[model samples]
Target: LAQRSKAKDWTRLIYSTALSPHQIVRGEPNAADREKDEENDDDFFTLKKATDVDADSMDATKETYPSDQLTKWDNEEMFDSIRNLFITGRNDP
Candidate 1:
């Protein structure tokens, strides 16, 4: 039931995105049909101001547990029992 609900939500999201005004209109200017009285004015308009952003502020660092404190999953008996689960194991059920 949860999977169906999630699938429905995803389908709705995709459908809405595909049919949205942004996707339909695309790069066409919104005011293209406006009066051309200002055609002599050649001033260009930008949606956003261009600025140099600090690259150092975007660096991401991850904190990791020390090797000595890491959890180990090596067990001889368990390895022998589940060896078939590995990729190279025999394809028997």
Candidate 2:
């Protein structure tokens, strides 16, 4: 039937449009093209590289705590509590 053939044609069009590459669908330049343009424009910008002195100052300023001073949780117990709450639909275990 003509209606069935039209439905099939529309289905094919929808699928092909969905599955096609983004650039093809949108008629835009792909990532490779943009990357090529970026490569060409790299000379226009100046990038600052971190010096050894900066790195050393950053490392010297960090504070560290002892392992025993940090709060610890039993992961298995926490997971079981959460699972029970979800299964029972109750806030308290």
Candidate 3:
């Protein structure tokens, strides 16, 4: 990690190709393979557009964090007790 961080062009060292165990253990890129990889530079770092994942049927806001618990409690004193557990509420001056 340290060596990669110090490198001038650290991103060039990164390759997304899958390798077999034997190839990994050998730990060397053949000249022909290296040339081929260099030729197809655009294929390596190209990013695809993300698909819209939302179903659009459900109400996203209410589904995320239901405010029912906060509304039901409705007590400032109860909240004060919970707040004192944190550093901001520490009274030990």
* TM-score for each of the candidates: 0.18, 0.19, 0.22
Which parts of model 3 are misplaced by more than 4 Å?
1-63, 91-93
lDDT of 3 by residue, 20-78 (tens): 43454454468997786566676766445333344665545654447976674577766
Best by TM-score: 3
Give the Cα error of residue 38 in candidate 3, in Å. Answer: 65
Clashing residue pairs in candidate 1, if any?
Answer: none
Q: Better model by TM-score, 2 or 3?
A: 3
lDDT order of candidates, top first: 3, 2, 1
Per-residue alpha-carbon lDDT of candidate 2 for residues 25-66, written as tens digits (9 for 90 to 100): 344456886687677666866455333254445535677877
lDDT score at residue 72, model 2, on the 0-100 scale = 38
- Those runs of model 2 whose alpha carbons end farther than 4 Å from true positions after fitting are 1-26, 44-93
TM-score of 3: 0.22
Q: In every candidate, how many clashes are there?
A: 0, 0, 0
RMSD of 3: 16.4
What's the CA RMSD of model 2 in angstroms? 17.9
Backbone clashes in model 2: 0
Model 3: residue 43 alpha-carbon error in angstroms: 59
What lDDT does each candidate get? Answer: 0.50, 0.54, 0.56
